[model samples]
Target chain A: MTTSREIRLRSRPQGLPAAANFELATVELAAPGPGEVQVRNTWMTVDPYMRGRMNDVKSYVPPFQLGRPLEGGAIGEVIASNDPSLKPGDLVQSNFGWREAFNAPASSVQKLNTHGLPTEAFLGVAGMPGLTAYAGLLRVAALKPGDVVFVSGAAGAVGSLVCQIAKLKGHKVIASAGGAEKARFLKDEIGVDAVIDYKATGDSAAALTAALAEAAPEGIDVYFDNVGGGHLEAALNAARPYARFAICGMISMYNAEAPVPGPANMALIIGKNLRLEGFIVSNHWDMMGDFLKELGAWHAKGQLKWRQTVREGIASAPDAFIGLFTGANMGKMLVKLA
Target chain B: MTTSREIRLRSRPQGLPAAANFELATVELAAPGPGEVQVRNTWMTVDPYMRGRMNDVKSYVPPFQLGRPLEGGAIGEVIASNDPSLKPGDLVQSNFGWREAFNAPASSVQKLNTHGLPTEAFLGVAGMPGLTAYAGLLRVAALKPGDVVFVSGAAGAVGSLVCQIAKLKGHKVIASAGGAEKARFLKDEIGVDAVIDYKATGDSAAALTAALAEAAPEGIDVYFDNVGGGHLEAALNAARPYARFAICGMISMYNAEAPVPGPANMALIIGKNLRLEGFIVSNHWDMMGDFLKELGAWHAKGQLKWRQTVREGIASAPDAFIGLFTGANMGKMLVKLA
Candidate 1:
């Protein structure tokens, strides 16, 4: 028997989850059965969507059950395998996270080709968040060449990729980040046309409107929304005629105790003929091949870049997740377990 | 020369428009010049969208110019013609309303066939409103056969037609109306599968949610939003996965003195994978030919029916328009001038 440390949901959260809501316990793992493999996790992701799963609500994804190990995107190395497809020492990706080691059916995990790239890229740029930015812009928003695009949460995992991709696609890109450091990173590293430090302004809507007018005088054709509430309202105010908004995530309202108000100017949608569509990347798995090919090419050409705020060891997983609500991370927030 | 009584917009309204905002004056009209025709107005349409044009803000249609005759859909007969394209007694439709008689270029008007149907049908069923219902449902919403559809303001011009068209296409439709009379019209005349009397319920969202659950327990596939605010919130809550919303108009908040709140549950758009698109019928003029052909067939087969609230004379046009905000009209509201 092998001992593995795992984080389990002790109870459903009321508002923002506390450290007590998660219980870290050591579990004895059984040997791999037929068609199964034992994986020692290397890295695990903590995303905003995971917050919604902590509550007992019917949503796109099932709620994380009580007293069970939390599930998310993770990259691990196969330790023991009874399946023909995967062997010991092979690297793989699976939806088995918040645990140091796990035994899952081999069919449930995807074998990874590192291709000399960091294995952790599968959790950030080449993984779920990256694919989200790709499918949302290309398919949902129907972004065109020369289109002016605005992205909120511009320094986060998904928004960072979206800004880079929009720039590479021959479109003018405007981004909004929280702090000075994030704004500087977006401007200096990603090379966005404009970066609005949303934290500096007292009135978010007015600030965004002024920033957008200066960056895109003709108004934005596409708005990729990662943070909803004020960001959504600001985007609506700055949208051009027939603008498209791809609603990826709304990180701002994830910890709200009560129902928050929506944009006051939603009626502008009728006058401007705007289209707002919400999507999940998992639903568009068919686009994975194209996304990987293009992303790989961009990375090789030195046009793509990424960052991470990683916490070491399985014990730090809860703190990492709680930090996402406070905008503590510059890029993807992950926990490394070796 | 002849005298024509015209109603002009004297000034923009602060909130809801009043009769003082318009000026009715008699103007001397000149004889038909080269390529022009003198038309005596017969029927003029007063629609909900006209309210938006009363504000000095930029919108889908340009704001009605101050100190000028307000323009809208009108049907008139040519009393005299100078162009070869039109002659005396020819019935034509033009965007020259709020006037008893006017002289316009013959090229500016569309000669109507009528085809044993009333000439006023060109202003309601065969005109912009009908085409709006067709393109919004078939094209914008991408309506599929056997899909369940929910229509707000179901007894009005566009919503009533949408119900019949959805029914004709083998889809189940649930309708919402403001009163018992309008509900009866929707059920008895339009033959909608279910009807919700929105006014009778104290809480709009709860009432709509309960009504929708009872009517379409599987959840609505398409939502045609004529009334925004709470209705939109209820629709968002009752929508199934991958649902579509064709936002044609939002009559509820048109006369608000202050900025009204939007749907609080818009985040459900993400979990449900919903697509909310706003459209202007003018942008879809390309679908006119197909719209007329299909609508004409339905009317001839007795599969279509319509109602109108007619107020006599151009002087009653202001009252007719104001009545729309109070839900005073059952279907198309019009002013008969001849």
Candidate 2:
């Protein structure tokens, strides 16, 4: 038997969760049962969507069960396995909980297929984030060559992938990040056509319009929205006639208990024939093979890149998750278990 | 010398329009110039969009030229032609003004390819309204077989075709009309799977939800929205996990000077991964040839049926146009001119 540290949901959070909501407890792990694999957690993702799992409300996904350990995307090393598909020394990714070590049915875990890329990339560019950007932008938004693409929350996990994927798709990509550093990286490093530092921009509407003019000139064809609320309203105003908006994640208003309010310019849609679609990565698993192939090719071609914000220990997962809303991460935020 | 009686915009109106906003002027008509054709208007369509042009506001289609004859969809007999492509006595459809006679380039009129259908059908079933329903429901909604299709303002032209097309496409159609009679017509005559009388139901939300359930045990797949405002919110609440909403018009709140309030459920969109698209039939002209072929085939197959709310005189165009918001017409509203 091995001792494991498990993080359990102590209470349902109201909004921004406090540390009091999570309880760190020690549990004894049993030997791997038939068809089961035991994994030592290596790296786990902390995302804005975690806040939704903390609430009891119904969403596209089922609410996280109370008193249960919250599970998300994670990368780990299988210590031992009774299942023939997985064995010792295999690095894997699983929908595992916030724990140091745990045994799961072999069916529940997949051998992380990094395919020569960094194993941790499974939790970021080659994983859910990759598929979300690929399907939402290309399929839903119908992103085309010379199409102008704008991404909100440009420094976050999914948003960063969206900007990179847009560029790879041969579209003009514009990104908005919190500060000058992230904006510079978006433009100079990532090769995004334009970048807006929202912190430096006093008026978001003016800044957004000016950026659209400078980058798009012709007009925006697709908008990948991660930050909603007022930012979404602003995009609506600046959106070109016949523009398409892909609603991937609304991190800005996810934690609000009350109904979010803003300018109601829905009439613009009628005048412009705009197509706005809301989407989740879960609905797009079928596109993974296509996504991974293209993403890998783009990365190899130097047409795509991604960044990760890493933290040490399970105790830092909550902080990393919360800091996502404050625009702290450069790209995907991961909890690294040493 | 020929004299023609025409309706001209006398002045712009704010809020509810009065009779003083229009003038009946008689003008001497010139003979058709080279490459010109003169059409004697026989049937004119009055649409809610006309009201939007009374005020100086930007719209998808250009605002009505101020102090000029108000133009809309119409069908007429060609009285004179000087162009090589046209001859006299040919029936045609024109985006010509509300007038007795006018000369325009031969390119302005398309020979009404009604395939022996009624000339007035050019303004209704065989024209823009039919294309509006066809393209909006099939192309934008991307409706599939057995999908549960819901249409608001089902008694009107585009909405009526939507119901018929949905039914033809093997969908269970639930339609919403303003009164019990039209609701019954939607069910019994149009053969929609279900109907909701918004006026009698009082609580449109509950009525819509119940109607949706009665028609769609599998849940709603597509919503062709014409009413907008509270109805849009109701549709959002009643939408399935991945429902598609096609915004054809917004008659409910179009006349309001200030934006209508309540039904703030856009958060449902992101939560449900919904797709909402807005389009006008004019932009999809490329699809017209195939659309007319199919629509004519359906009509011959008795799978298509349409009603026209034809006003007897050109002088009654204003009332017929105003009646759209009040739900006075059973189908396409048209004006017959001598």
Candidate 3:
């Protein structure tokens, strides 16, 4: 038997989540049963969308139940297997995160062929976040040549990739992030044309609007929104006629106790002839093959770069998840477990 | 020479416009000079979109200059012609509205081919409003089979047509209008599946949302937004996953002194995967052939019904235009200027 430490939901969060909402529990894992495999988790992912699952409301995915180990993307190694399809010492990916290890049916996990990439890369740049940026920018926003893109949360996992993709496609990119450090990373490391340090100037809609106007004098042709609230309003004000907005996520409003008032300039959508579309990456898995092909080429060419803010173990998973709201992570927020 | 009476923009409006914002002027019309034609106006249109031109700011169309005659859709008979393309007593359409008579170059007007339809119908069902309903419902909203549609301002010109087209295409339509009269017209006369009388319910977002929930229990797939504000919020609340919104006009906020707050549930767009798109009919003239073809057949089969609120002569033109805001019209609002 192997002892595994896992985090369970102690209670649902009302607004901003706290570490107290989570409880760490230890579980005993037995040897693999028939057609089963035993795995030891190496890395796990904590995403903004997971916040919605914590609520009891019905949404695209069912809400996470109380007193249960939270589920998410995980990368692990199959240490033992009873099925012929899997062997010892094989890397695998599964949705059994928030735990140190587990035994599950072989069918529940996918064998990973890293193809010279790091094992954790499957949990970040080469995984769901990468596919999200690709699908949102190219398909949802219907990006065209010469289209200028404005991205909010530009230092985060999905948004950082969005900025790079727009630049790679030969479009001007204007990025917005919370602080001076993230702003510098966006401008210097990501090579974005313009960076708005929303933390420095203040996160008010007026501040963002002024910064956007100075950055893109003509106007933005596309807006990829990861942070809502003032960022959405700023994008509306800066949108040119016939602009397209891809609503990927709204991390800013996720913790609100009540519904927040939307952009005051919503009427501009009509006068400016804009199209605002929202999408989830799960519904767009059909594009994964194309995304992997393109992203693989870019990755091999050293054209794609990413950062990770990692917590040490499964015990710190809740802290890593809560840090996302406070801008504690510059790129993908992850938990490192062995 | 003939003396013609016209309405001019005396000043810009601050909020809801008053009669004092307009000025009545008399201009002398001369005989046709070279390629110019003399036309005696018969019917003129007073549309909600005209309110945008009354402001000082630049828009899709130039602002109506103070001390200048207001321009809109007008039908007239050419009394004399200097060009071979037109002749005496030829029916024509031009943008020289708000005037009883005008002398303009023949190239400035489109010669009318009424095809057994009333000449004034050229200004309503056969003109921009009809095409707006077609393009907005079919193309902008991308209505699909089995999609439940929700239309706001269902008693107005463009919205009434949208409700009818959705029904004709074998979709369930839930309509919202003002008062018992318009509600009756929508349900009994227009044959809609459900009706919500916004005026009777006090025009609150909560009222509309409750009514929409009761009407479309399965949730709406498409939202045709003619009235913004509370109606927009209601649509967002009642939208299903991947719902589409065709924003044609926002007559409710056209005369506001400041920008109105948008839908409070704006974040729902991300969770529901909704799409909100704004459009102008003028940019979609390429679809005119398809619209006229479809609308012509519906009109001929008596499948479409409409009502007009008419104010006699050029002197009452301002009254007709202002009446639109007060829910004084059921369908097309017109001025008989002959």
A173-267: candidate 2 lDDT, tens digit per residue: 87878888798878887888888777877434546666656666766778888877555666776778888999887776777767554335676
- Estimate TM-scores for all models: 0.98, 0.91, 0.98
For residues A61-165, what per-residue lDDT tens digits would candidate 3 score against the true structure? Answer: 899989999999999999999999999899999999999999999999999998888888889888999899999999999999999999999999999999999
Winner on TM-score between 1 and 2 is 1
Per-residue lDDT over A1-338 for candidate 1, one digit per residue giving the tens place of the 0 to 100 score: 87999999999877787899999999999999999999999999999999999989999889999999999999999999999999999999999999999999999999999877899989999889999999999999999877899999899999999999998988889999889999999999999999888888633666777877878888999999998887888888889899999998888777788888778788888888999999988899999999999998998899888999999999999999998888899999999998
> How many steric overlaps does candidate 3 have?
0
* DockQ, each predicted model: 0.81, 0.46, 0.84
- Give per-candidate clash totals: 0, 0, 0
Candidate 3 deviant stretches above 4 angstroms: none
Please provide, for model 2 over B1-338, each residue's C-alpha lDDT reduced to its tens digit, 9 standing for 90 to 100.
56788788888766655567887788888999999998888888988778878778777666776679998888888888899888888888888858878889999888876687888877777788888889888888888876788898899998998999888878888888889878878888899987878887764555666665665666788999888765777788778888899888887767777655434567677778899998888888888888898988898898777887878876887777767877889999988997
- List model 1 lDDT by residue over B1-338, tens digit each: 88889889998877777889888989999999999999999999999998899898887678989889999989999999999999999999999988999999999998988878898888888888899999999999999876799999888889989998998998899999899999999898889999988888743676788888888899999999998887888899899999999999888888888877677777888878999999989899999999998988898898988998999998999889888888889888899999
Candidates in descending lDDT order? 3, 1, 2
User: Which consecutive 10 residues in model 2 chain A have the weakest lDDT in total?
Assistant: A202-211
Chain A alone, model 1, TM-score?
Answer: 0.97
Q: Chain A of candidate 3: what's the TM-score?
A: 0.98
Judging by DockQ against the true structure, name the best candidate.
Answer: 3
In lDDT terms, how accurate is model 3? 0.93
